[model samples]
Target chain A: MRAVDTGGYLKGRIRREDIISAAAVVYGEVGYHGASLREIAKRVGMSHAGLLYYFPTKEALLAAVLERRDAEDAEREQLDSPPGLEVLRHYLALASHNVRHPGIVDLYARLAAEAVAPDHPAHEYFKRHYDEARVGVRDSFRVLAESGELRAGVDPEQATITFIALMDGLQVQWLTTPDAVDLVGSLRFYLQALLTVPL
Target chain B: MRAVDTGGYLKGRIRREDIISAAAVVYGEVGYHGASLREIAKRVGMSHAGLLYYFPTKEALLAAVLERRDAEDAEREQLDSPPGLEVLRHYLALASHNVRHPGIVDLYARLAAEAVAPDHPAHEYFKRHYDEARVGVRDSFRVLAESGELRAGVDPEQATITFIALMDGLQVQWLTTPDAVDLVGSLRFYLQALLTVPL
Candidate 1:
């Protein structure tokens, strides 16, 4: 039941989490417009109304799906973060993990892209995510900067935004064309550049 | 009839291009799946099937839309890109331009996101885009390195991907929330840090 299962154990739980996971996969494979509630119900071996019984509306279902994805990301955020060079190494690991099962990253970013629509149900979720994430990143960045791990004068908030942008952008290229994405290597180099400064 | 012209002018000229522009707007405003060919055609004072006559299908239409946006980008590419701070400055200008028409940025990125599906019509376009873009960036970095404007030990290809990735990442934020994007200012800061050691 741990959402943080390492080898991708999110596939086989019978709880609401299972349904949410199935929803993410189905929704990701097809887009929000193309994804059908009935299809998602079918994949989970339930009737359409039955699935609706639990989640209520298509909007609620999509919200739950995004919430689950965010939960997974949030869980990863709690892992013991490495320090100094290890932080860069951890980023490389993160890149490799994302490349291997790209659907996760795709789903996250696709939601963000679609969130721009005025009526997108995920709008509030994305806005909150960005706001809260900016705060958290600023805090962590301050820690790293104070420890001399980060280059001087790097605005934590701006750096956070830029970092998120890089992750989303790189995933766009990688998922669309893996060959163009060096995954771990390109990020490793960038991180090296970022961390390099007069020590 | 430029695809991204946000200012008012020539609204009724060149019916075909106007239709594409409408589709671009709809796609950007409501996202790909949320947009309707009917809405686009309506904006252009045409019927749905009538609009299809010019572009054939929505997929082809989306491709053309992306192509038109890239045309502007290609124009920017034609400029003699100066190295060091100049490259960053021009890059910021590109960001400012995209910010003016966030919808164009949205439309371009949505196509890239959808291209991950094996059957997406835009698959080849996104793939070719990344490949050629990577090569183009590498060549540019090579020029900078040769002219003694690049830091020693910087890999042009890695730098290329990183720059492109950062552009994409920052672009998402910029498009979603333009006020938050300090394109030129922050980019200048990053480049100043990055270009510390020249050639």
Candidate 2:
């Protein structure tokens, strides 16, 4: 999904992003325990050994996939302190991306849970990501409060982390109970309320 | 850790509760794929088939274990209407419990993730659980708003779902980054802010 950043990297037939994308699919379809390198290689149209030429190992490949998704949030942080409501707008956009990305969020959430084990490939990835996400959202909300746009005493940092939790958590429900509720719409409604509170 | 209210559950050496506790430890130690009936049976001092006497199947046994944790939650809910700062207090208490009951949460999370496949055993269990959790939280928040305890325009229902999401989403974070931050504290601080209005 990335542009030709490198000068036609090895003819671009086997792109780095392509490998990461395929890895994400396998990670989502199968639990990390159940995911097999052979299956991911097959889906990517590479010999099992050939795929290793690109990823080196399944753990490395898994790490790369996780990093690629993490960059999406990092990009949001670069958008120059948009208004608090605007930040919420972007948050909604990212949530939609999760809905469309098909397995990225699920894989992210699932792997995140596993990262608790000290030996997980994702342990460090989650450690730094959580801090950044928590602080970044908090700062964004704080800017809103300073501008006299917040609902007052909103605890931007706290709200920010909690907001992340809500988003992540609802996505879980959506995965398990697609027929039982509309997760996106529900989240959107909540976001709107939090964004605009009447005294 | 319960006293049977004047006359506890048999006041015996080992009983149903002890069996359930042992099952949880085995389940957590090995996971669903790695854990075995023989292991749990041995931990509880019983034959595999004899263990089946109390629980006819492995699945039934697991469900009972999970239900036992949820039962504790229900008992706590009965003790509090959870007004004022207790909103966050309850949230943190719940998170603490989730941490202590890793096996139950881990199993629930795993099954919830797998339930996306449509044929998982915990499919119906999770589907109903999410439905109830979402609707129940929403209704409770609605009551909060109606009673003028909450600021206007905060749709309690949506916020309720949001609260549930926060729990689910952060549990993943807490599992992954247990040492880096206080997950429950962060959420409570946010909820406390959500409740109070600005000067």
Candidate 3:
């Protein structure tokens, strides 16, 4: 009996992970508001009921998709520790990488805008995301400042806000006119201005 | 006969303008996709057919809404001449102004994101908007640079991209957590860093 229970739990966990991967693809292609559970299930070769058994609702699947993207990004960048200016550089590289993944960028752009509504399903998720992201960037700046890597009179908190804002703002432009906007060059220039030593 | 023709033309123009105003409000509230022509007509106390006579389609109404917004913003700021640092200051003030008008901001946020898709109705509008905005900002920076107002080695085009990006990015954060993010203060800080003399 104990062996059977363990096997069942493991199978369910694996199934849930697979469903999340498939859902991410769907969400990226059609956006959160435009995507349907039925389509996501079809992509995974599972019935709608099977998908529900794992996610219960579209919002639940969206949360999982967001978490998976974050995790993958962190792993890809090896962002385990505060890498100071290197993290900013990584962000620029990520922006370039994002150009190749239109669906994912669309997913984020659409959801971020939609999540602005107070009663949106992902509102809390986005609120926490910005708060935590701000703090992380702030701490990175503080590290750079403590080491005298940042320019004189630079405020870590303010730099963090500006850095994050520029990143988010550039994505919209890049999505619209990919060739016109040089996302990495713009960010690199800003960082050079902010840093004591040119990145 | 000429007098009557002139009077009828004036009345038609007035009615068209009235419908555009009502449409802006509706689009701002429910966004482009969520809003309906019937709702906009109801808001203006006009028949649906009458509203259709002016707009022809929802896409046409959306185009007018976007144009009206740009016209109003331009008129409000008097952004006709290159004001250099004053442009940055104006942006900060605009951010504050945007807070009071969440509906208009929401309209912009939603439409801008939706317009990322190739076939979206406002796609061309957004593309032209970013291009024109970047050029205008770049020209302003060039003027400031020539006058030795900008910091040494500051690239006018790069600054243009960063400035615009930060403004757009801050809007997303501000819309979600209005109290937490100081949109104007953040822009002011970035501008101070970019300028040779404090504003």
The most accurate candidate by TM-score is: 3
What are the lDDT scores of the predictions, listed in order? Answer: 0.68, 0.66, 0.82
Per-residue CA lDDT of model 3 for A1-199, tens digit only, reads 9999999999988888888988877776667768899998998889999888888878778867887787787778655466587777677677777767778777777778877888777888888878877877888789899989999999998899888888778888888888888877888888888999777
Over A152-174, each residue of candidate 1 has an lDDT whose tens digit, in order, gives 76665566676666777888877
Mark the regions of model 2 whose C-alpha exceeds 4 Å error after superposition: A1-18, A25-35, A43-46, A50-59, A72-84, A193-199, B1-19, B28-34, B47-61, B76-92, B99-111, B179-181, B193-199
Q: Distance from true position, residue A61, model 3, in Å?
A: 2.6
lDDT of 3 by residue, B48-99 (tens): 9999898887877887788888878877875556658777667677777887
lDDT for B181 in candidate 1 is 62
- How much is the lDDT of residue B195 in candidate 2? 57
Interface C-alpha RMSD, model 3:
0.9
Q: DockQ of each model against the real complex?
A: 0.47, 0.51, 0.81
Query: RMSD of each candidate?
Result: 7.3, 6.4, 2.6
Weakest lDDT window of 10 consecutive positions for candidate 3 chain B: B77-86
List runs of model 1 lying over 4 Å from the truth: A1-15, A25-34, A42-47, A53-59, A73-89, A197-199, B1-18, B22-35, B39-50, B76-88, B176-181, B197-199
iRMSD value for model 2:
2.4
Q: Please identify model 3 stretches exceeding 4 Å from their true place.
A: A1-9, A27-34, A56-59, B1-11, B27-34, B56-59
Of the two candidates 2 and 3, the one with more favorable DockQ, higher being better, is 3
Candidate 2 residue-wise lDDT, B91-170, digit = tens: 56777777777666767665566555456555666676677666555555565666666666566656666677777777
Summarize candidate 1's per-residue lDDT along B1-199 as a digit string, tens digits.
Answer: 5655733334434667888788877886777777878889899888888887777778877987887777767677442354344554566677667767776777676667767666778788778777767776677677777866776777877888877777776766665566666655555555554565421
Choose 1 or 2, whichever is better by DockQ. Answer: 2
- What order do you get sorting by lDDT, best first? 3, 1, 2
